[model samples]
Target: MRVIEAPSPNHEPRAAGVPLDTVVVHYTGMPTAAQAIDRLRDPAAKVSAHYLIETGGRVLRLVPEGRRAWHAGVACWQGLSDINSRSIGIELVNRGHAWGYHPFPESQLESLRVLLADILARYGIPPARVLGHSDVAPERKTDPGELFPWRTLAAHGLAVWPDPVQPPAETPPVAWFQARLAAVGYCTPQSGRLDDATAAVLAAFQRRFRPKAVTAAPDTGTAARLMGLTASA
Candidate 1:
C-alpha cells in the first residue's frame, strides 16, 4: 500500500518488552483533516497517531511503528493501562461527534482495510485486538463512533463482529452483563449494579456492536449481542 511520510515528533520509545498487540482506531474530531493533522504534528499538542487515512484514500504515516505514539491517553483495555505503549493508533479523517458525525467514506475505509491487513499480518495482531478509541477509553471518547462500518471490516478479517442471537428467556442481571463485557476485552466493572463507569463501558460496547441503538440500557437485544460476542470469544 502507498503511504505519504508526514512524521510527527510526539512519540517516545515503547516500554521495555511491550508487544504492540493492539490497534486502536479513531476519527479526527476536527472539522477538517488539515486542522487535525496539524494539531497531531504539533509538539505542543503532544498527540500523534501511527497513521492517518484521508477521505479520498490517501494514507499518511505520522509516527514510526517502532515507537509509541502519543495516542490513547488515559485509556485502558482488559485491565491494562498505558494503552499507547501497547497499541498502534490509526486516525480516520472524519468530522466526528464534535463536528458532524457521519459515516466513513468507502475510499477511506478501503485504505484502512489495506493498511490494517498489513499491520495485523506484520505484528501478529488478532482481529479481536483491533478496537475503536471509544473501546479503550469509554467514558472519555466516542470517536470512530457508531458510524464506523465494523461489520465490513470484520468481513475482511480486519475486525470482530458478532452474529445475532436470541436473548435469554429471563433477562440477566448487571453482573452478568459485566462479566460478558469484560470477557470481550472491555475494561468493565464487575459491580453488581450498573454504575456510571459500567454504563459508560456498556455504551461504548453498544456503540460498536449495536450501533442502531446506543441507549446504554441493559436491554434484551444488547444482552443478546453481548452473549454472542462472549460465546464467540
Candidate 2:
C-alpha cells in the first residue's frame, strides 16, 4: 500500500498465541490528520494504530502489524476482551463527531480499500471480524461514526452489509435482537429486556448498520435487518 514508515513508541508485543484475526477501523476524531499523528506518536498519550490513512491518500505505518498498538482500550468482541492483542487497528484521518464529522474523500476511501485488502490477505482476517472501534467498545466508543460509509466498505468485500430491510409485520422482541447481535459477534447483553447496556449496544449496531434510525429504539427495519445479518454474513 506504499506506506511511509512513521514508527511510534506506544506499542508492544502482542500476547503470546493471540490470533491476528480482527481489524478495527477508527477515525482520528481530531481537528486534523497532522494533529492526530502527533497525538499517536506522543508516548504519554499511550495510543497508536498500526497505520493511518491521510486525506490525501498517503498511508503512514505507525506500528508493525505484529505488535499490539495501544488501541481498542477497554474493549471486547464476542467473548474476547483482549482486543488489542488480537486485532490490527487502522486510523483514518477525519474530524469525527467531536470537531465536525464529514464524508471521507474518494482518494482516502480508495486507499483504504487497497490497504484493507492487503491486511486481510496478510493475516487472513475474515470479513465478519472487520469491525469499527464502536463495535468492540459499544458503551464507551462511537468512532468511524454513522457517516463512515460502511456499505461502501462492504461493497469492496471488506465487511458484510445487510440489504434494505423489509419492515416486518410486527416488531421482533428485544431478546430476538439480542440473539441476532450476539450471533453477529458483538458482545451484546442478551437480556430479554432492552436495558441501558442492551440499548447502547443496539445503538452501536445501528450506527454501523441501520443508521437511518439510530435511536436505539428497536423497530421493524432494525429487527428485520438484524434477522438478515447472519444470512448475509
Candidate 3:
C-alpha cells in the first residue's frame, strides 16, 4: 500500500471531456527494473506509465493520474483510439517476452491486486475495463503476457474471467467469431475473412481468455470463450 513518488515527465494534459474509465496492465519489457525506470523517466524516450511496480512489491508513481502518460502507443480498444487519454497505464516489472517470458512473482501480483482495487474503486472503472496491453494493441504489443495470472485477479473481482464452458459442438464461421469479438470489446476484423489481422486479434484474445493454447485459428474453444464473454457483456 506504500507508493513511492518517482515522477516521469513523458506525459501531457488529457483531452477535455474525456472520462477516465480504463486501466491497461503492461510488463516493463526490459532486462531490469532500473533500465525500465530510466527509460520511462527519460524525456527523450517520450513514454511512461502512471505507476510501475517492481518485482519485490515496490510501487513507484511515475506519472500523475491526471495527465495522459504515453504508454499505450498506437492502440485501440472498443473502437476508441485515444486509449491513453482515458486510461491509467500500470507497468509491472518483468523481463518480458523479448528477454524471457515467465510467470509474474506472487509478490508482484499481490501488489497489483491491491493497486487495482484502489484504482477501480476511485475511478468507478468496471472489471471489464481492466485490460492488458496486448488486449488493446494486439498487433504491436503483448506485454503482461499469457503467464500473468488473470484468474487470480478475476477472483478478487478486479478483472473479468470467463467461466469454463464446453467448446461448441461445431466450429462457427469467421463472421460469427468477428461479431462476438467486437461485442466483447475487441477491435476485430469485420471483413468476414480469416486474415492475418483477424488471427492476431484472436491470438490476443486467447492469450487472455484461453491461455493454454493461443492457436490464433478460429478453434472451438476460442470461439466458445468469445461467445461466453459476448453473452455476459
Candidate 2 root-mean-square deviation in Å? 1.2
lDDT of 1 at 183: 91
lDDT of 2: 0.90
From the highest lDDT down, the ranking of the candidates is 1, 3, 2
Residue 43, candidate 1: alpha-carbon lDDT? 98
lDDT of 3 by residue, 90-209 (tens): 999999989887789899889999999999999999999999999999999887889988888999999998876778988999999888888888899899999887898999999998
Clashing pairs in 2: none
User: Which residue runs of candidate 3 sit more than 4 Å off their true CA positions?
Assistant: none
Tens digit per residue, CA lDDT, model 2, 1-233: 58999999999989998899999999999998889999999999999999999988899999998899988999988889999999999999999999999988889989999999998998888888899999999998999889888898998899888866677899889898888888888888877999988898899999999777789778888887787787666
Better structure of 2 and 3 per TM-score: 3
What shift in Å separates residue 188 of candidate 2 from its native position after superposition? 1.2
Provide the global lDDT of candidate 3 against the true structure.
0.92
What TM-score, computed on C-alpha atoms, does each candidate reach? 0.98, 0.97, 0.98
Off by over 4 Å in 2: 163-165
